[model samples]
Target: MIGKQLKPNFIFEASWEVCNKVGGIYTVLSSRAQTLLKEYGNKLIFLGPDVWQGKNNPDFIEDKKLLKNWREAAAKEGVNVRIGRWQVEGKPIAVLVDFQPFFEQRNSIYRTVWQNFGVQSDKAYGDYDEASMFSYAAARFVEIIYLSLIHKNKKVVYQAHEWMAGLGMLHLCKAAPSIATIFTTHATSIGRSITSNNKQLYKYFHGYNGDQMAEELHMDAKHSVEKQSAHFADCFTTVSTFTDKECAQLLEKSADVILPNGFDNAIVPKGSAFTAKRKAARKNLLRVASALLSEELFDSTMIVSTSGRNDFRCKGFDVFLQAMANLNSELQRQSTENCKTSVLALIEVPCWMKEPRKDLQQRLAEKEIPNTALPNPYLTHELYNEGEDAILNTMRSLSLMNDRNNPVKVILLPCYLDGEDGIINKPYYEVLLANDLCIYPSYYEPWGYTPLEACAFKIPCITTDLSGFGQWVDATLKHRGMIENGVEVLHRNDDNYFDVAQNICNTTIKVLNANKTIRNKMRKNAAALADKAQWNNFIKYYYQAYNFALSKKLK
Candidate 1:
């Protein structure tokens, strides 16, 4: 039986993205980490894969003094763990586990899991084996920590993010019963698979059976692990109401807690500092564009960007490119000076790339940019899969070749912007701060952090109703969101490709044509919206979830 609300004395969170910076989950955990540290202090422990086993990971600094006894104990059991502090806004204790040795024993582990929790991984492919092995090792690490250090009576909780970490929670269910478990599926594998495969998710959501869909889509292993984890975990949570529904239908389980993603304002620039950064960012962006495109650009040039995972249809890269094409065509036909003020749309999505463009790097290094445009002037980097890339292919189809006369010049910055990419040499956030407008027209987003981040930086954004953030904005405004102030939540469904493209074109033009005074107000309004979504305001939900899990006293 559950008692009154109780706080967990200790928490161990496992995610594939602990020291890894692969996807949005990294953003989710990293941004909230500081606030979480404030709440739990050193009692919080984050476990991640030891992907950087040999080389140094700048994000993690191992402290031999910290958790010395536990490391020794774990090592004795063939578990190699490096206890360190993650270098982010909040320096929380992290353990990077080396699961390489455990790979040999995966078959036995999977067999036992199949017998106990019905987790089937026979057909698992690609990263599934690696992730399962990592999770299994993470769970083993937690078990060691609990047995060797943690008290029997102390309230404890273990939270796993995504299906990649599901095996760990399931492992803990059998190995460590005293510790409460929480499994969070950011997006159900089957649901995302369905969307990416061009099947209508919303229209036929109710009729689809998750298990049937899993087998049909060949996502049985992922769906199986995730589904079992939901049933096995003591408490289940999701990042948004949108995903909560997806979990309900696609995974056959709804979240016990809806912990919406939030931002930490501590990382964001403030007041006059913000102004200086924004101006500097804009200047740097325009300067780079001028060097690459060989075009004279003014301060009036609006820098717009769209960034996320390079899931072509899922992230709406196709629609965004098509919209840019449409907008370019419209602006070319117009005579006004405002139309002549070029819109520089940057595609910040990362992909399989060789390196920074050698010619672009040379141009950037010069004291003065050459008057002539470089070959493939639209690309910030050369790609290994130049002919096979979806975004580049779509751009070719739409003829967004960044011609000098085009009013909208599109540049694809196809590498991760971590300030050391040889060109641009600025982090995504730094480059983002300079944007006059941000467009994240996602077709399938659980909780859109990009738009929220854009708003937090006082940049106006255009999102769609399908995104959880966009839905929240619409609800906050008491109607469908519009560009009159900060966000514009355009209505998007599976069938309206060109219609959505035209709408994006229209909304972006409105922002480009806006005067300085109107634009400033828009920026303020965007930040005001962001203010309501800080971790300080949203962290309560996480605490509540912890308390609920603690009260259960799963032991």
Candidate 2:
């Protein structure tokens, strides 16, 4: 059932988060999974890092016979096979390396490294052992996959995600040089570091001490892994058209093709008849605002919010904060007769949990820095309900301080939310329904999904001209006044925080004043634009990636 494809095509993917994820890669892979199963079921072999099951619930017993056959084949092909599996949903999917060696010794490694460097583990370093073990285990897993597919007489296309799995693909090439490899980086380490290092103010407020943290975590190896990944892959792919160009320059390796990540349209809110979607969005915002009001965080009137994984520096949370502060100043300039609006922008970011170690160590060592990062408080429960109480409690704090009578309220929600909650996770739909506008000024986004999502919801969103989606939407619509003048797109680096704030304020003013019919037209235009990115069309591109690799074509 697993290997009988109508066409002889296969995708060998290595990732830290395919089976379990920490970022957007999970959404991309999950969206494509059913389709891959439908089109390339027999040929698709997903190879992931082999995290140990240990005494965890529902033990996953690897198919020893199948594994033995794989190992025997690898031995014949002169490739080392490291085969194992972590228990996921009670079945084994052939995860490659046993990570227990690294996991078990993590505390010791942390103690040794941090203590040697005269730093504490919690304060200076973060999951150092987990990252290191992930790389080692991932590399070994790819070696096993190289033997399984290549030695077994299968033509395959190997796609590695980020630096973690990028190394794995490189390791695989040592054993199977003919395997076509695709490397995709969701974000670059250097680009992010620039923001973190340049802005000391960010670490100061966010409860993270940047200078000390940087010294312990080795930012240098992060750059090295990125460069190595770019150099080794036959072809490179990034999540967005904008990111494709950004990555080539940042990593100094040209991408063969730019594959903008696609989303599952079915999961998106659609159609006017989708009242439940509308309700879900509205309720979520109200719940969040209510919580903040209860907590006494602010007394502002205009409530502005942004959500994402809690990497504040790169996601432009600081920009949003500064913009809101600017908006506040501008609002104050208005006379009582000119219409005053008070605003509070809430920035939400979910912390990254799992990290790849090889790059981590390499980075720390190269910089001669020693540091560790902390896991998020809500890491254990990804869904909104699991962390609902905490979220409400956080909101309650904000609400108690902020006046409900104020013109605007701004808040930052740094949590992982889902659809089941009917509110917090409904980003675009909710933001469109409640507020006048949403801000997504990403410093480096690989094919941003939010802008398109907001457009689909009929929300007038402000994205940077540097974004792939912004460029695409602006180009397609030709700015024919379909969207509000305030619904304008600005280039990120072209302006400082002041200029950025002015543009945002001006756009908000424009959209808030736009005629009803015109606003409706913009919504239609957004939905039309989103239709172009349907999964059906995007799947073909993926198929082509596999086909090109199979045919041994460079492009």
Scored by CA lDDT, what does every candidate get? 0.88, 0.53
User: Per-residue alpha-carbon lDDT of model 1 for 1-555, expressed as tens digits?
Assistant: 224567888989999999899988998899999988886899989999999977979899999999999898889888999999999987999999999999899999999999999998987988999999999999998898788888888888999999999998899888988888888888889888998998898888889899999899889899999999998888899988988988988788889999888998888888899889888888888888888888768888888999998888888888899999999999988855544538999999998989988888788788887778998878888899999998888888988888766889998989999898888888888899999899999999999999999999989999998899999898778898787769999999878989999999999889888999989889889988999899988988887788767656644
Model 1: pairs clashing at backbone N, Cα or C within 3 Å: none
Residue-level lDDT of model 2, residues 1-555, one tens digit each, is: 213222344566666775564666655675666556666653565565545344432223455665576566555544333444433321334445455555665466435433332223343224433544565455554455565544556566778877666534655555567667777787765556655556432223334333333444465444454566576666676766666655655666656666666655565545664556555555545444443343222222344456555555456665665565555555546536533334545555554323222332233234232233212311222334434444334444434223433344554344344333222545333445544356777665656666666655555677776566676666756763224532356766624655765677676656555677876666566666667766666776666555545555333
Best by TM-score: 1
Q: How does candidate 1 fare on TM-score?
A: 0.97
Lowest summed lDDT window (length 10), candidate 1: 333-342
